[model samples]
Target: MSLKRSLNRALAATTGLQVRKAPRPSAPPPPPAAPVYHEPAAEDRLLRRPVFVISSIRSGSTLLRMMLDTHSRLRAPHELHISRLEVGYGSSVSEYAMQNLGLERGDLEHLLWDRVLHRELVRSGKDFIVEKTPGNVFCHERIRDSWPDARFLVLLRHPESIARSWHESDPAKRPYEKAVTDVLRHVEAVDRARETLDDACTVRYEDITADPGRELRRLCRFLGLDYEPGMVDYGRKGDPELKRGLGDWRANIRTGTVQPGRALPGSGEVHPALLPYCDSWGYTS
Candidate 1:
């Protein structure tokens, strides 16, 4: 999400409001359990079993990260675009092309990204590390390549809210198309990953803000951690270091509490073009 959009959300979200969504007649009871994780070999470094918080920008993934960071067993650090560095070799004439270079460049990228995660884990001395960067959702395979045991935590927010936040963040293009397209792409990316990985867990942004403890406790079990009381007190005990590193994305969480968030006002009707995404993802119109 853009800086302006981040600020707009910050200004508007003083307190969260539930939209009172209608009950899901077809929805199953107990919801779905997150993927079960088998213990890895003792030799496998805890750093290798990284956890990823994946979603599009402005979908509350950052807030989720901050909350998880407060956990004793977990550390949610700054964005490490590990996958972005793994530019697979392909035939192209562009300067960033990896085709001409042998496996050298790709190997280097893997090495650097791996080491970064390793260092972060070592510094925090935590059992696991969760990296949050919205764009990470698009590079599931790349992440898998580096750490076969890496786990994913996927988050979804209403497309209406996503599009509005995206457009508000960027002024150069000044239209909603790009925002809508990005949201759709992210939605598809997350769905594919859930289908492919047993270590993946999915959650909704609305659910998180609606009852943070419930959603987070579910996430905790998914990641195989015991829930700590006050895990949801992220708003009150925010991380200053994290806030500074986040740039404009820093505004709201700095409010020293998790402000109750609802669908953006007047966003009851999702845009027509974005309806396909809503239907597929279970977002009400």
Candidate 2:
């Protein structure tokens, strides 16, 4: 073979050897840059204020829940009876017996309540969780200890209206004696809660119903939330879950009942029997 031909043969062999070698697997496309989620900061979570509605039964707490639930950021649960059973007494008898037995401190704070609430909110991806637990009025201190940043809304109705409504609903089930006892208990609870919680505010049912929009706006301002006009006519809304059981007291009351006409049953004031307790809370008659 000629020298030039030999050189050409050598070049061909080198090219063939290079072609036989395995190709470097294309650099595995840079493992997808770890997903960067712009999640809310811890400070943001701490800043969130959970609104708790505390009141006695038949005091239009449902109305307040309906109103607040209309806000896009708020999630008001039906009635999470957390306070009385979890943090304080189980019932009137239990409460009375505990007092008689000199039961002072309650059980340790349970995470079950918070876990359930957090789970529900997480599943729904809701920001605000409003718990409308009527029985919580007695456990304000426990609540404060649990959620220092929580905002409380106390719903007030005329004792007469509350008692009358209770009687009308199931007179056989709720006798006048029970109704009066509940009112008295509620008054005492409210008084104690007021003294303990400076962040608490009370809303009268009459004021709420008479001018719902105004009251809702005021409530939003108090809670540091933006008021939504939709909250005003929550009963008239399309969402059935939001609309149920609101303002139903109107239908339940009997004709010529002492409660139907006035904001409160007598003189638009707290009952004379409950006056001292109301005064303790700085509540005006």
Candidate 3:
């Protein structure tokens, strides 16, 4: 008998059990990863090195937008929400035509976004443009692909404060619990951007509100623009008034003065759902 069979038979006869082979150890699961995107050829796009602000709702991005908008060389328009813009083929024949032309739905949408922003920059007579749409945090990589030379500013705020402000923005429609869930999406997205986008700049709402001029100077350095005094006193320059859908319309923003941000929420007061993000952003400690 084969030695293996003899051993198995002996074990079965002696102990009423066969020599059972151990199952192989499973390979460790791969680490969690984010999607990777590549930019299209240079000829495919119009805009270059445009700045985008990646932030959560109610993170004081509107206030920063107003400041940047006042810069002579830079234009910071209201929330463009351009990433949500999508393209669709009208028919299968059209889709086939586009496929043959080497254009996909995403590629077409990227072209549209680039052209739209380029038109805005041309109209404003500015050398550079900055867009501050909060939802862009979720699609930083896609934006990078669209404008291979895109710059980003990752805006952050205390997680609890963001959720509270969102709820209070429309209390009747957005209850506290729902607000936490909704805002958590943004908070997590911001964290992801911070973790992944090493080239992006990061600033806190509290820091911006605490010292407007200083923060504006820092931002100017990042954007490669001279710090214009007009950007510091944006209110006096007759900026576009705060429209409801475009950005913060609260009396504070309308007042055109940088107001101090609310105190950070105590650890005990933070929602459990937001704790992990809070920790990730260094808000808890």
Question: Of models 2 and 3, which has the larger lDDT?
Answer: 3
TM-score of each: 0.71, 0.63, 0.82
1 versus 3: better TM-score goes to: 3
Q: Residue 263 in model 2: shift from native, Å?
A: 4.5
Which regions of candidate 1 are displaced past 4 Å? 1-46, 86-104, 171-173, 235-250, 264-268
Please give, for residues 72-140, the per-residue lDDT of candidate 1 as tens digits: 989887676666554333544542443234334544466667678888888998878888887777777
Q: What's the count of clashing pairs in each model shown? A: 5, 0, 0
Q: What is the lDDT of residue 36 in candidate 3?
A: 27
Clashing residue pairs in candidate 1, if any? 15-260, 16-260, 16-261, 235-256, 235-257
As for TM-score, the candidate ahead, 1 or 2, is 1
Candidate 3 lDDT tens digits, 1-285: 888889999998989888777999999999744422245898887777899999999999999998888888888888888987777778999988977878777778888899989999999998888999898888888888788798999999889999999999999999999999999898888888888889988898988988888888888898888888777566732335667888887777876678778888874999999988887787773
**Candidate 2 local lDDT, 1-285, one digit each (tens):** 877677667877877422234678886666533211122324323324678877777787766776677688888766766543344446888767755644433422234455566766666567878888777787766666556577898777766677676667778887876776767877667666766776678788877767777888888988778888877655443343433343333432211111223544444544467666545544455
Top candidate when judged by TM-score against the true structure:
3
In model 3, which runs have C-alpha deviations exceeding 4 angstroms? Answer: 1-38, 236-240
RMSD of each: 19.7, 23.9, 12.7
